[model samples]
Structures are given as C-alpha cells and as structure tokens.
Target: MPSVRRALISVSDKTGLIELAQGLTALNIPILATSGTARFLASQGIPFTEVSEYTGFPEILQGRVKTLHPYLHGGILAPRDAESEAELRKYGIAPIDLVVVNLYPFVETIAHPEVSLAEAIEQIDIGGVALLRAAAKNFASVTVLTDPADYAMVLQQLQDRGEVGEETRLRLAQKAFAYTAFYDIHIASYLHSQHAPGTFPDPLLLAFSQMQSLRYGENPHQRAALYRSPLPPAPAIVNARQLHGKELSFNNIFDLDAARALLQEFPERPTAVVIKHTNPCGVAQGETLCAAYCRARDTDPMSAFGGIVGVNRPVDLETAQEMGAMFLEAILAPDFTPEALHLLRKKRNLRLLTLPLEQQPTTSPWELRHISGGVLLQESDGPGVDPSSWRVVSARQPTAAEMEALLFAWKVVKHVKSNAIVLAHAGQTIGIGAGQMSRVDAVQIACMKAVLPTAGAVMASDAFFPFRDSIDRAAEAGVRAVIQPGGSRRDAEVIEAADAHGMAMVFTGRRHFKH
Candidate 1:
C-alpha cells in the first residue's frame, strides 16, 4: 500500500467529485484544484487550496497556463528516492501523492458539425495532459485516475485499507496514459481532416473508440473487438440500431456490410440484396419491398440459407411475412412497420438492423487491414460507373433493354468478391458465381446455377476476361450481352468471340476488384 498525503484534483466533467473529495478529506489528505474546479468544490462546501496558491504563480493566458508551473510538475514527477527527496527539500516543494485529471472534451467538442477549429483546439488541454503524464510516470509514489467511474472503487479502498494498493495504482497509471493518447489522436485527426482532406500524411493518426467486445473472431480460438470512428454519427453500419437479434458475430457483421453496400446503389427504387460470407449471392430491384425481396430471394434460395439481407425501403407486413418464410441470419432495412415488427419479433434470434436509406456515404474515408507485422491503408473503392464512359466494344450493339439489364448487373457485380460473375434478367439476378480462382470457372458456375433461361440474359464480370475462353463460355450459355472492365491481354480475341456469337458487349474503363 502507498499513502496519499496530498491529492490534486481537476476535471472538466465533475461527476461524483464531491463524494471523492469527501472521502479524501476523511482520510486526512489535503486537496489542490484549479480555478474552475476550485469554484465547484467551494460551492459544494468542500475546502480546497487553489493550484495558483500552491504554485505561488498566478495563472496567465486566460487560464491556459494554469497548473503548468514547475512547482506543480516537480511535486508530481519527483521520485521517492533519496536524491529526489533532497532536491525537493532544497526547493521546499512537497510531493504530490495523488493526481486526478481528465482531459477536456475534444471528442465531444468536434462532434458538433458547426464547431470551429478554434473551439476544438481550445479543448486540447495542454496543462491537464502534462499533469497526467507526470503523475503516471511516477506511479511509485502517486496514484493517478482519469475516469470518474473509478472514484467509488478508489474511495472504498482508501477507507478500508487506509491507502491505495500498488496494483490499483499501476492500472490507473496505464489508463491515464491511454486517455491522453486517444485525446491527442483525435486532435491530430481533426486538424488534418480540415486542412488536407484526403491526402495521407507521413505519419497517419487514427482515432477509434471500442464499441464492444465480440464473442470471438472467425475461429473460436481468436478474440476480437469492434471499434468505430471517433467522428460524429454518420449513416453507417456502426451507427445502425439493432432492433431484435442475438449478438452479432464477426461473420454476420461482414456480410451485413456487403449487403448494405449494394442496397445503397439502387436507392431510387426498392432494392434487396442477400449476402453470404461477405459476398453478394443475390440482388434485385422492384417497386415494392416484397416484390424486390422475393425476386432477390428466388435467385438462389439454397445459397441464401442463413444469409444476411439488406433492403433499401421500409419493410411492411407483406415484406416481413415473405422474409419470415426464409431462414435468414439477419435483415437490415430503413424501418419496419408495426405489423412487420410484431410478426418478425416472433423469430427471437433474428438480427434486425435499421439504417436510413437516404444517407449516402459519398465521402471516402480511410480503410485499413491488419497484417502480421504492419497495417495496409487505402481509400475506399471508387464511385458508381458513369454510363457515358462505357463503350460498345462488340460489332453488335446492345439493345436498349439489354443496356438496362447490363448496367444493373454491373452495379451488382461490384459488391461480389474478385473473379466474380453475375447473370441478370429484368433487373434481377438469375445466378451469381463469386470467389472463384479463375474467371472461366466463375462463368461456368454462374451458368450452371441459373434456374431460368440464360438466353437473352446479360452477364457482368468484376474484371475483364483474361482469355477468350470466358467469352466463349458465356456465348454458349446464350448470354445475349456482356459487361466488364476491358483491360485484358487478349481484348481483341475476346471481342471477336463475342462478335462471332452475335453478342453485344460493353467495356467500363474502371474495374471493381473487391478482395
């Protein structure tokens, strides 16, 4: 146990301050506080010496320089060794045995969309951070606390054992450092985002807050947690409300993201997407949610077993009743009607997420993937394909109706994994082949899985066919038109194959390769 003879306390959020101060006073320890905290303590009838009085130096710069004096830092940072004691005696500075400091609300300040840079910078909290660092570095003689929630535990320990233990002190010191580190990260991220929006700096700083601990990762042996951006709430899966569900597993969240990404692409009409293993299995658009969901579900009901579903429109009773007939792992939509909610709630373990359909994620944010020794950072994949940029590469031009189906398949293929192929007719997917090692294999699998006639249907590929074999296979399956990003080694041969089959093909300059 370590004795706390003198305690310094200063906090912007003063929850439970009076009780902690009372506990410390009962233990016969004096209190030191800053001007604002001192005023608060005085109003509560808890006596405390002002930090200025203890330092013998008046605060300047409109209180920005408060508690930054050497007398304060020296008291907190000095070691308990003989040399430190001698130096403290020479300076007539007493050692501070405890420090309670929480940084100003920089995260909360920037959450306001209208907040200015000056206001956010003002909340960076220089003196409070310095005080916390000094106290934490000398934990051998001091107890540091950054969260008011810990006050009750520390108060109980002080009353029962007469002092805080070394173990508790060590934990508190670690927490204090983490608090300041996250605060500085938020400040740096905000300033950079304001000045250099999309440019990556030499040393990138990421600000994240842990939302919850997951049950496990993809495997039982691995542990994982979910973290989200420190910025204000946006239209995101992270900000979605889980209305009814068992806790989301890592796999469930991944598939939900895939489904929602496709749902955003066709928000003008009711859209439905079914995803499995982070790859879209089926997709469709209709005037009603029930019609869209049934068409999407009918594409590959076998593959959609226990899959995640995303819809761009509110779910009514008819849609909910149709969805309830399937064994789905989760459903995400903008809203659910009362009848829909009541019917769906019967499936107690179903995961239902609600996110508004109107909020488009137009701004690209930093995306990261963890490696063994380092991390890889990249911007999100580019925006929707421009219709004017697509060129007719085959001799036979795609009919107006074929163009509509081709574009619809093109949008759906972007959400599938690499080496992906989608077959669509009438704005709904007929079959999909994803995550194949070869493009020809994906084409074959997609044609094999089609329950409806492939004749007059359109085909979309994530990337161009490397050889003419994929185009030959698509033509044999009666694919009337093809859409792909044309940059293959044998582009002329592939176009010749399409022309030989009297098929129309369009080339998008950009490729959407989702790993």
Candidate 2:
C-alpha cells in the first residue's frame, strides 16, 4: 500500500479533529476540508485547501453542495489500478488516501421532544455519508474513519508504517458501514414513527450495538453476544454498570432481567426477587432492604441457591451482609452503599450490577421474540390490572388483609410463566408453581412446594381456571381468596366451586400469560 499523501476531513463532532489534521500536516499530507471544517483548521493555524477551491466551484445550496462534487467523491472512490489512475488524472482528481468524517447529529437532534420534522431533516447528513461510503467501498486503496476514538490509533499507524494496514482499513470500512446503517435506521424510524404511528412498517429496520460477547449461550456449546438498542441509554439491564465480580453469562442476563422485571412490579416499596432460569423462585416486599431480600430468599431457599437477586432499593450494608451468607450468582440493584460494595466484593465471583431507579419506564412499548424463520412482536404485558376494575365473582368479598395478599400474589403471578400459580400471605410469596401444563397441577405444585405454611394464604393464577378442579385444589390447600382473569368457558362452575369453598374470588378481567 502507498503512503497517505492527501486526506479529506469533515466532521460535525470535532472531538479529535485538530490532532488528526495536525498529525497529517506534520507528515506533509495535504488536506481538503469543507467550509466549516476549513474554518476550524484556519483557527488552529493548520493549512488546508477548501473543498470548493479544490473543485474550482463555489459551494451552492447553503453549503450542502460543497463536498457532493465529483472532484471529492471521484478521488475517494478511485482504485489504485492503472486504468482508474488514468481516469482520475484525466479529470484532475487526486487520489484521497484517507477520509475522516462523522455524520450530522440526526439521532441527537430528534431526541429532543420539541424538534420539528424540518429540523430533523436538515440534520440527515448527505455529503458526509456519501464520502464515508465511497471511501469504505474503495477500502482496498483508501482508509476511512467514522469514529473519533480511531483517530489516535490511525495516526499512530500512519506515523509507524507510513500508511494504514489492509486489515485496519477493512475493519474501519466495516465500522463506517455500520455507522451509516445505524444513522439511516434512526432516520427511518423517526419518520415512520411520526407519519405512521401505531402501525408496523413492511420492512422493519432494527439496529443494535454489541455490548459484550458472552462466554456461552444457554448451553456451553452455543455462542452468544449481548447487544443494546441504538437509542440513548436508559435505566435497564443492558445499561447497568457492573460494579463487581466475574463476567455475566447468557443465563445470568436472562435471570437478571427477570429479577429486574419482577422488582419493577413493586417499586412503591423496597422489594426483592430471586430468579432462576428466568422465573422467580422467591419475591417479597418489606420495611427494609435486608428484610425484603431475606424474605424473598427464604420463600424458597433451595431454589434460591446461586439465583439472581434484584432489589428495587439500593443495597445497604445489612442487606449485603445478609446476601453474603448465600452463594448467589448475581445481584441487581438501583445502587449500593460504599460499605455494601466493600462487603459484597468479598464474594469475588458474584456479579453485581447497578441501574438507577429514577425515570425508569414502567413498561417498554414493544417486546420482540425470535422464532425459527420469523420474529414475534407485541406490546409488553405491564402497567398491571387496576384493583378498582376487579369484580367479586364469588359470594364472599376478600377482607382488607386478604385483599392485600391477593394483590401481592396477583403482581407476582403476572411475572410467572403460563399456567402459573402463586400462594401469598402478608407481603411475601409462600409458594409458586410456574410453567406447568395444567392449571390444577400448578395449584397442586404450589401447595407441594410451599416451605412456609399455606394455611390462610391467598392464591393468584395467571389465567382463569379451565375447570373447577383448580379452585377445589386451591381451597383444599387452605387458600382463603383467589385472584385471576376470569374469562373461562367454565366460569360459572369455577365461581360455584369458589362459593362452595367460601373462598373470596376476584376477577381481574385481564390475563397475564408469560409464555
């Protein structure tokens, strides 16, 4: 590869522009820059030929037509072969060895709630994208850079080798393509969201940036990676900061997400949930963080072993000390006290992640699941059922204490898998049966799994009973009240069974099937 002789520099974000341009100039590499970039270079006392001057045509259309000329792109797109070199010389087009450009801030501009469509369109970036694509396409002869972070490395390489390596050029080309793709996706998403609200587009464009490569997927044999949406960071598992311990595994991320989702259901108080295989083994709310964690863990201590724990409140010293007693895989929390971090760091293998509690969205607008040949998209099942909308379908209405427990169980059952059954008393779960095939089996499993006494416990089911057998089973297990979305064909028989057992049954009129 020939040494870098000439470069084109234009960027909206001037993060490392000066240093890059200065380094190139020190190496006797001339620069061709747009009007705005030329002004910056002039201020820095760096010599550069303006793009219009190089092309011998004045910039038209409010500076938008400056770098769109053939002189610029012809140089960037020309190959180093004899025929291409002759054509470039015939047009007086010098070969551009480097193209450093970052597109306009379209993503940042549209993020403002008051940004107008015209304003967003103005920031769409035409010339910059074209320059990057042209250079990336001719990467065999040209080097392209879209990220400022690459400036120092590229400069170092140029200083050391007199030109960028082929491998580095290919990598930069890949990054440049990805940058343009991400930019286009954001623009299309914004326009579609504005013009075709509440409707899915024919061609769905999704963009994600890799956050990390996991050691393995669900099984050790499968490969996996973690990617996050291109939008601004939010308080979420993907945005969480890892404060301690080993790298998070694929299953650890799944269980942590489940734990976080369950904690979101009870944000009004300090709540804790223990998750295993993306299902809650235990969940509870208490006056203190420690109490909540202890209650949630004790709900099913056997299943809580090495499970992920999520807390709504910041982890305190007492809570961390309590957690130290168990061999937990990971812990997710809003924050952690300094003392707590010191104490928890003792468990060197436990993953600790923290996401702030402020401004967390109650539910995401959409959830996506991948299938064999297609993808499934739907609205998230959240914001929960309103207690005022619940109807008393049984002869008896739940008392105040029973209603509290029933509501708690209802909140928990929504997070459980389909055919889910949860038994609760006070503010803590007593037993939970999830992902069962039969509703009656879920009830029976809930009873059999109970470490705490099931007597006086209230029951909550993810969906209505298909028959009266589930109600009879719950009644026999000493459940005093039940909450479920009653839309079954056998609703009458189920209600009759609840009435016969003197159990207060409330119909939420909304089902939460988490399959």
Best model per lDDT: 2
RMSD (Å) per prediction: 2.2, 1.8
Model 1 scores a C-alpha lDDT of 0.88
Candidate 1 weakest ten by summed lDDT = 357-366
lDDT per residue as tens, model 1, 207-309: 6778999999988899999988766334578878999989998888888877777877785788899898988778998878899999998888899889999
User: On a 0 to 100 scale, what is the lDDT of residue 411 in model 1?
Assistant: 93
Q: Which stretches of candidate 2 lie over 4 Å from their true place?
A: none
Candidate 1: list runs displaced more than 4 Å: 81-86, 113-115, 362-364
The global Cα lDDT (0 to 1) of model 2 is 0.90
| Root mean square deviation (Cα) for candidate 2 | 1.8
Candidates' lDDT values, in order? 0.88, 0.90
Ten residues in a row with the worst lDDT in model 2?
357-366
lDDT of 2 by residue, 37-93 (tens): 999999999999998889999989886776888998888888798999899999899
